[model samples]
Target: MNLNELLTDAVAGAINTLYGMRPSLDIIQLQKTRKDFEGNITLVTFPLLRISKKSPEETGANIGGYLKENTGIVSGFNCVKGFLNLIVSDAYYINFINNSFGNNFYGFKPPDTGAEKIMVEYSSPNTNKPLHLGHIRNNLLGNSLCRILEANGKHVIKTNIVNDRGIHICKSMLAWQKWGNGQTPESSGKKGDHLVGDFYVKFDLEYKKQISELVAGGMQEEAAGREAPIMKEAQEMLRKWESRDSQVLELWEMMNQWVYSGFDVTYKRLGVGFDKIYYESDTYIIGRDTVLEGLKKGVFYQRPDSSVWVDLTKDGLDEKILLRSDGTSVYMTQDIGTAQIRQTDFSPDKMVYVVGNEQNYHFKVLALILDKLGYSWAKGLYHMSYGMVELPEGKMKSREGTVVDADDLMDDMIDTAKAMADELGKLEGLTGLEKEDTYRIIGLGALKYFILKVDPVKNMVFDPRESIDFNGNTGPFIQYTYARIRSVLRKASDAGIMFGEKIPERINIGNKEKSILAILYDFPSVVAEAGNNFSPALIANYIYDLVKEYNQFYHDFSIIKESDGNLRNFRLMLSDMVGTVIKNGMGLLGIEVPERM
Candidate 1:
């Protein structure tokens, strides 16, 4: 029932008859007519000129004549230069729009059969700190991607691989230990993760001071800094904790719980939760064993220092270390183990790693290693690489302590939303808690929309000042549109304005209404494309475009007019359907469509 499909078939048939040869065309895009153009849906005749051996005008005339002769669907046709412009009947547009009402939300249709199962791993946060804007992007993308895939009838497993154990975590432990007061989140009145994060920051400061003193004391001429007292002490603690030193192990477990607890709150707020969680503590040894097996099978090389590596020179890269000299598993090694574990657990048809673009080479190396290890499933592994989230000022550097904390960013957004709501006198009818919830929904909607608006491969700036505007291409605009629709629906319900019709197939299309209908008709194709491309931005862009078109239609036409029962009822149904699509699309992007924002 796709209008483009019907149009393409008709155009291709006409072209074939006109030229005595079949023409190739799939999507005959219906574009808006410009001032010079007599009709929309222009068919460029330049490609046909060589075959037709005629001038551009002659070719266009032949094609336009053939289309008019062969098809009843096209209302009229005009030839201008090399362009054959076809005008589709208003009746056809009306039929297409009316028939779309009963389709699934967002015009989505489930896959016919044999859909592949996919596992998407994203929002892999470290337990040493709380979530930040970077994690927000990951969460939204991952969560929305899952929705998109599901809409396309693919089975999707949304997972998170928590980097819970590392030398960095040991530093926080060291700080808490030497500082001596065993403080819980409750006792310290600090958020669990932030409390742990405070210790992490404390560790860095003290460790720096300790390193400076060591250098002043002329410890090994400052070349062996990692071997200094502070760093070495942190490393020693890591070893002890790994060996399950009773007190150290207990503290590590406790602090990790604190961080995870804090993360749960943030995840709930963001409206994204993982289906499964993988821990480095559990997978590192599995990676070690996998590497050892690879070494035995001659897939990897071991150095005299007892480190294992893969010579990726064949794959246009240097030898990547799979294991450290101390017999510890490296990042790549743990990844291998995680992949194997996931394959065993789910046996998914596709495994998507939603990591940042800086690790593009790393993922390439991983695919090579997996293939070398003789896993056929390795070929199906995909790297969903996204660019780093930069602030309006510049890139965030974690080492420089300039990275934005995820929880803090969320708080700031919420505060901004509340202020805006207060200024508009919008929260006056709501209770304090209801007001808080409203702000949270609007704030998070803005954050998710901003992140998902940009294509994944392109770097985006987080402009705190204007990213959440209600008047333009922003989350608030979409939310307000949905709210307006909801309000209309409520009013209809209260006024007993039934949408019932003897013939539910009637569509009365104005110019603006037809434009909105065209966009609405494209939702299925948009969702499918987004899923295929692994870009939630596609859905985000589609929804924004949909709502924009709807707004234009809303301004140009009245849906609530007391007179003209058929037209008003049809328009109300159209608005309601559009509202459903918007809500569904926003939901896929991990955004809330507030009913009364």
Candidate 2:
């Protein structure tokens, strides 16, 4: 048990012996004592005033005295108003360190057999464009959540639903066919996704030009947009592709394959992947079948134009379209089908969709529709909605070709890391290859950490320069601290110092040493909290706080140079534990920390 649980049980015993009443666990309010106070755990005695039949101070003193006298755990106590601050004996912390130190998986729990499985769906990228800043945040949050959840001992399945077949996809294909004289990724010498993305932009530009001309010729803007020749052609292409026209299907398959190849490269570079990938083309038909079945069962209604929809007015939502009038399935249909497919495959206990906040209403309607369709697992579906990520310049527009491509952003971060490291002379002893690899680690670490350090629900601006800084709460700062700890341990080992065994029991540990131990004790709880809240920012910030504290402790104390063997060994072991926790925490964030920098 942790310190708090031990103290709680002691308090419960004290309460029963003194007051002749058994209190619920909720009545035992134990918290970390404030820094200004002289204790490790503080109990609020105000809640027990009625049972004590005394004032707050008297109640606190009674409990404090009882704990100190009855239990060996409490070394001393102080009554500050209604607060009972109990100081734990040095032996308690020493015992904690002895038991916990040298444990590489100190904070992680192995998954139990027959655990509830959670499926997390993220990076639902449309095949028409390469990933950008927004997708980066999505992937990082989703990927980190998986790690955090697994750390909490849940079986997590990472998944992606590729938006491969849609009108937007047709826009790129048609543009490629009409404008390009048989150009391909190889012929254009560009990444396949980038090439396909260029055509998407081209289609938008031509469509806008057509709209402007039609409006100038006395047509309404909406009418012009719907009637534009390119828009008509793209819609027709979608219909042909749906009908399995050999030529259109062949083109669709070829372009989607190219996009898939490009997406794999990006996902690998971003350190995110999926156990299963569902395509819109494959799931839409299942959705159509399901919706048609729902219609026959009166779960849905058909409009005069023959479109299928579900009325969610009773659930405080408006009607949601399941299929267009021409029998093409909408996004909602594919999502329903995808959820069913996943349920059949994994039988997950929970289904999580890691999409942005803009689709909030869409998911809400989806859950309601699925419940109406008699899927009991619909209630378990969760939307891990996050806000958008923008650069310092402003919001990005994909169709305008103004978004920062994920591949380009990663390259820029690495280059910036190299420049910063070079300017600071951090790469002096490293060979060219080592320097490059270190730069990549620092660069990618910075990118992932900066984006994830924020609460996922809040929109924020990303600055590359600020993220790579070596002195703040940035990833490199924590990474550098870890490297420093490793260096110290190496020197200690070379000097024939042994840290494999626990320190001598009689050794005295100061408050700084105890403080590090306290934080280390909180790692498992922090991981649990991160999992419970589904927020990686908690883990990110926890590591930052730990690193910050360790840096102060390092500056204030001597480890390898200490004259006392026990003291030096204790400090070295403590430092090693801190480094291990740091590496483990960063690993949960899908970031790598260099051993030497």
Candidate 3:
């Protein structure tokens, strides 16, 4: 049992003996003692005042006295005002250290023998351009959440919905057809996504010029944009692609393949992947057919322009369109279809979408619409809405070619990691190849930790240099602490000194050691809380605090170099277990911890 549970049980027995009444577990509230106080856990005597029929101090003193003398875990107690702070025995911590030592899955629990799977959807990138900084945050959050969920003993399925169709994609295709002398990824020597993205930017440039020309000819800028020939052609291309016109289909297939190849490379480098991927081209048809089904059942209304929509005014939402007048599907249509397909495939207990906060209403309407169509699973749908992530300079616009491409961002991080590592002489003993691999690990760890440390609902600016720092609650700092512990262990092993998980008969310790044990004991709760809240930031920050505490303990005491053999062995065991938990915690955040920096 944890500290709180153990104290509650002891206090309950004491309450019945003193007041002739046993309190419910709900009435027995306990929290970590305030730092200014001298105890590990504190109980408020105010709640038990009615039964005790006495003043707060008297009630607290009575219970504290009973527990200190009657229980093995309650070493002592201090009553201040109404608060009863109980100092837990050192043996409890020592026992925890011994029991937890050498256990690889110490803080992790296995999934139930038979549990329903939770389906999480993230990294829903468009094929119109390469994945950008926004997409990077999406992928990292999704992947890390999946790991966290698994660590919390849940069966998780990681899925993606690739937005590979529609008007934006046609713009890229049309731009390439107009401006290129038949340039391909091979001929241009550019990554496929970058090549395609260039055409997307090219389309914007020319389309703007057309808008300007029309404005000069006495047309409003908005009207000019609508009347632009390039925009018209792109719209027509979308219709043809939807109808599967032979030539348009061929072109779409070729370009999308190029983009997919490029996306795979980026995903691999970013260390994120999906077990199952749904495509808009496939799901949009299913969505359109489902809309027609809804229309037939009077669940939706058809517009005079031959469009499809659902009026949610009664549900406190505005009308939402499913299909346009031209019989083409919008993003919502395909999303509906994707939801249905996944429901059939996984039959998950819950479905979560990791999208930006901008789409908060979109998801709300989606669930409502699904429920309107009489699907019982609609209630299980959730939107894990998050705020935007921007660099220090400012926001990014994808159409204007100003977005930071995922590939480019990762390359910058790795390169910056190399420069900093070299400057600090961190890779002194490693071979050339090992150094390269370590650079990648450090770079990506920095990127992931920087993004994951912030609360999901907050919009924040990401600074590359700030993230890769070797100190101040950063990834490298925690990693270096782990490496330091490993160095100490390695030296002990080399000198033929051994440390085992067995508890020593008598070993000297201090408050610092007890404090470290307290931190270690929090791992299971932290993991569970992170999973419950769908926030990997919880795990990231917890690991940082653990590293910080371990560092303080390292500096204040002697481990391998201590003269006392029992003390030395005990400290070694503690250091090793902390390192193990550090690795396990970092693993849940989808980060790597190196033995040496």
Candidate 4:
């Protein structure tokens, strides 16, 4: 049994024997004691002081004495003010690790409690531009959360809603039409997506100029509407492209293909991919008829201009627009349609939208509208909202061109890691190809860890320099710890030491190894908690602490240098188990771990 369980039993026994009515102590948590405290578990006894009608000291002393008399787990108990601190025996720590040594450390075997299938939608990027750091954050959270859910034994379907057709894409088409000297990605020596993205930027610049000239030429801005010269040209291009204007359609298809291809590269590099992809071009109208039906059912109202909207004032928000008067679906309408389609396609117990916190209001309205529309499953839908990733300077602004490009940021990280590896003389044995792969793994590992280590709901600063440090609370540090264990395992293997057989031995209740075992025993709880809360940071923190403990053990204990063969084999097994836990834990976080530093 783990230390927490042992302590829980001890505490409950003490409470039952002292209070005489078997007062329940099942809900009591035996959390790790802070460094300043002498005990490993602290129990606040204030609630019981009044019930017992005794002084705080007397109550604590009574419980403490009871625990000491009844259970071997407690070495001693100290009454510190109103809290009862329980010091556990070193033997319990050793027993905990040895018991969990061969089992799944971080693997989550969720109870077979008949959970409903889940749908997670994330990384809905527009085709007109390359993905930026914001998209990276969204993808990571979505992908990692999907893994977390799946690890919890829930059937999870990951989907991406691609924003492929819109005014933004229309600009790209217009710009390509007007500026085309028939230049291709190959001819321009540019990434296909970036090549298309260049035209997108060009369209915005030119469209702004056109708008300015029209205003200067006495065109009424409001009266001009979406039918102005520049706007009309873009709309015409979209119409023609939709109607299969051979040349226009061909260019559209070609440009979209380039963007998709580029997106695939980025997704593969980042170790993220979706199970299914839904495009706005195809599914935009799925919700349109549904909303219209809602209108007939009096679930939504049509404004005088025929614009469709839902009144959300009852939910403490403004009315949300569903569709324009022109019958084109707005963002909300598209989302509603997407959700309906997913219900039909996967029939999940829940649908999770892993979007940013900026759209907190949007998702609130989404869930409300869905529920009002009479989908019973809507109540189970969740918005896995994550905070923005700001640079040291400030928030990343896409319109102002202050955004960090995903490809560029990843490349920069890999290059930085490679440079550090070279400077540390760690690149001597690695070939060019090995170095390239290592750089990718280590670099992406650092980036993913930095993002995942923080609570998803809290806004965090991404300092690229600080995130790559080898000795701090970073990905590299955990990876290095894993690598060290791996090296020891390899040496044992080379020395003809086989660790396959169980040593049939008890755990060593020594200094740091005992602490290390205690942490390892918490693996099941960590996985369950993280998966249940939809937070990968919990697992990240757990792994980081595990590594820290291992590091201390490595410095203080001798595993390979010990003279006793059985002890060496036992320690090797411990090291092997730690390595397994680290690898599995990191994998769940969507982070890669290198076998070597």
Candidate 5:
């Protein structure tokens, strides 16, 4: 057990002995002692006063006296007001460091065989465009969440649902058919997604021009938009594709394949992958059938125009459409189908949709509809809603071709990393290939860290320059500290010093060493908290605080240069543990630390 657990049981025992009443574990409130106080663990005596029948101070003094006299765990005690602060002996900390210093996976728990399986769905991108900064945040949050959950010994399946069909996709297909004289990704030398994305933009431009002409001819804006020739063509294309028209189906398959190829490159660069991928084309038909079943079962109602919908008004939401009058499925219908298909395939304990906050209502309705459809597992569906990420310039617009493409943004980050590293001369003595590889790691690390460090629910303005800086709570700062620790250990190894053995049983550990051990002891809890809350920001900030503390301890004392062999080895072991925790923590955030940055 850790120090807190040991103290909790001791306090419980003391309460039972002193008050002649057994106190529950919850009543024994233990917290870290205040910074100004000279103790490691503080117990609030107010709760025990009910059983002690004494004043607060008297109760605290009685508990403190009992702990000190009865247990080897508390060597000294001080009562501050109604709080009893217990100071542990140096031997406890020395033993803690010795036990934990050699553990490589110090804070990680092995997967529990009986744990429930969780499926995390993220990066549900449309085939119409390449992923952008918004998609980057979505992918990173999903990927990091998987790592955190796995660290907490949970079984997590990373999944994606590609919005590869619908009217939006038809716009791009129509544009390619009209303007492109049989051009291909091979001929244009552009990523398939980017090429397809260009056509999406082209469709918008032409659609707008047609709208303007119709409006000039004295038609209402909405009427002109519906009547636009290109819009009509795209709508017809969607119908043809849905009917499995051979020509349209061939074109759709070819374009989608190209986009998938491009998407693979981006996913690889971002260091994320999916165990399974679902497509709208495959799921929409299932959704249509599910909707018809819901209608027959009276779970949903059909309008006079023959469109199907669910009345969520009783549940504080307006009615949501399931199928259009033309018998085409809406996004909600596709989602319902996807949920059913996934549950059948995985039988997961929970289905988490790592979507943006904008879709909060969508998931809410989805869960309600699933429950209404008689699926008992509907309650297990959760929406991991996250806030949007924007550049300093403003929000991005895909149809206007104004968004930061994911591939381009990664390239820019790498270029910025190279420039900054060269300016700092941190890349000296590295080969051309090493410099290239290091730049990629540092660049991607900075991007992922800066984004993941923020609360997922809060909107963030991503500044590439600020993210790559080597100082102050940034990824590079933490990475640089890790690299510094690694350098020290390497030099110690070169000097024929080894830290594989434990520290001596009677070694003296100063306050700095004790403080580092305390933080290390809290690593597992920090990871568990992050997993429970689905927030990587918890892990991100925890590592930063640990790194900051280690840097201070490094400046205040010597490690390998210490005169005493035991003290020197202890410091080296402490440094090694910090480095291991740093690596593990960064790995949870899907960021890598270099040994020599």
Candidate 6:
């Protein structure tokens, strides 16, 4: 047992012995002692005060005296304001490390011991635009969440739903059809998604110009926007797409292929993939039919204009439309269809939608409507809402100068990594190919770490320069620390020093060494907590703190150079475990730790 469980049982007996009561869990609250206190575990005596019928100090002294005498691990005790602090013996920490020496992935739970199937949907990108900085955050958060759940032993399925058919997509297609001699990705020498995205911006500019002319001719702004020639053509294209017109279908298929081709390159570069992908064009039919079925069953109501909607006023939400008057399905319709199909396919215990915070109400309506339609699994749907990620001002921006493309941001990060690595001579003693791969790892690591380190619910500004720094709470810093540990292990291996099958005997450990053990012991709990709360920031920051502690331990002690053979070997074992934990912990965040820098 760990320190908490060991002390909890001992403290519970003390409460019964002193007060003649079987102590409840709440009454025997045990936690890590405060940093200011000279102990490893602290027991709150205030809870026991009610049963002891004494003052806080008197109650603490009563329990502290009992624990010091009876608990072998409790070497000494100090009491302050009824908080009983127990200084655990050094042998406890040494035993903990030795027990953990052989398990490479010490913190992760076994698969058979955790939750069942879970489906996580993220990177739900539209075909009209390339993934931008915001989608990068979504992809990273979702990817990390999947890994975190797996570490907790949950069977996770990573999925994405592509929004391939909409007025926005039609806008790009219409612009391309009107503007030029047919240009493709091969001809333009640009990424297919970028090429398609360029036309999306072009469509907006022309549509705006037409609206301005109509407004100058005395039309109201809203009316002019509605009547804009380009707008009308895009709407017609959408109508044709829904009906699957041969010409429109041909163009749609060609354009979306270009976008998908581009998305593949970006997804590969960003190191994210989906187990399955859904498309709106296919699922919209399912959603439209489902909504119509709901209307017929009276679960939803039909408006006079023939549109369908669900009434959620009783649930404290407004009415939500499932289909437009012209028979075009709304986003909600496609979502309903997507959920139905996913449920039929996976039968997952939970469905997590990792999208931006802007769509909070949309998901709420989705679950409520699905429940109203008698789909029992609707309650398991969760929205992993996150805020937007913006580049520092004057940095890279999209073609419209508002969004930042994933491809461009990654390029900048890798370039920044190369420049910094070269300047510091960190890339010395490596070949041309090794240097290239290391730079990619460091750059992507910096990017993923900087973004994942922030809480998912908060807006963040990503500065490429700030992220690539070799020191501080950054990816490269942790990566470098891990490399440092690996270097120590390699030298020991070269010197023919290795631990055997038997657990090492308890040796003298100093304050720094003890601190490292204490931090290392919390790894499993940290992974569990991160998985339970769906917060990767927890794992990210936890690894950073552990790295910081080990770095301090390294600077203050001797390992291979220690004069005593036992102490030196123990330190080597400690270093090896630290390295293993670092690698395993970072894996939960979907990060790779290079063996060398």
Model 4: per-residue Cα lDDT over 1-597, one tens digit each = 556666677667776778764556744556676667777778777767545678878888998888878787777888878777877776666555455566753466664568758889999999998998888888888888888887788888899999887777878877877896788888988777787888988887776777777778787776445446777888777667556588876777888888998899999998888889998777777888999999999999999999999998987889888988877778888889988888888888888889999999888898999999999988978999899899898988756888889999899889888988888877578788988888888888888888898999998898777876656888888988998998888888898777745554353445466566667767777887998898999999999999988988888888888777766776787788889889888988898888787
Clashing pairs in 1: 131-406, 132-406
lDDT of every predicted structure (CA atoms): 0.81, 0.90, 0.89, 0.81, 0.90, 0.87
Question: For residue 105, what is the lDDT in candidate 3?
Answer: 94
Model 4: worst 10 consecutive residues (lDDT sum): 500-509
Question: Which residue runs of candidate 5 sit more than 4 Å off their true CA positions?
Answer: 53-55, 399-402
TM-score of every prediction relative to native = 0.94, 0.97, 0.97, 0.92, 0.96, 0.96
Question: Which ten contiguous residues of candidate 2 have the minimum total lDDT?
Answer: 462-471
Better of 5 and 6 by lDDT: 5
lDDT of 3: 0.89
Residue 503 C-alpha lDDT in model 6: 41
Q: What C-alpha lDDT, on a 0 to 100 scale, does residue 302 get in candidate 3?
A: 95
For model 4, the superposed segments whose C-alpha errors exceed 4 Å read: 1-6, 24-29, 104-106, 110-113, 215-228, 239-249, 500-508
**Candidate 1 global CA lDDT score:** 0.81
Comparing 2 and 6 on TM-score, the stronger one:
2
User: What is the per-residue lDDT of model 2 for residues 1-597, given as tens digits with 9 covering 90 to 100?
Assistant: 778888889898998998898888898999988889988889999788777788888888878889889988898999987888888888888888888887898899999777779999999999998889889999999999999999989999999999999999999999999997888999989889989988998999999999999999999999999999999999999999899999999998999888989988998988998899888788889889999999999999999999998998888889888999999988999998999999999999999999999999999999988998999999999999999887777888665556877999899888988998899897788889999999999889988999999999998888766765656988889899998999999898898888757777678899878878888888999999999999999999999989999999999999999998888888988999999999999999999988777
Task: Give the Å shift of residue 231 in candidate 1.
Answer: 0.8
Winner by TM-score: 2
RMSD of 5: 1.8
Tell me which residue pairs clash in candidate 2: none
Query: CA lDDT of 475 in candidate 2?
Result: 88
TM-score between model 6 and native: 0.96
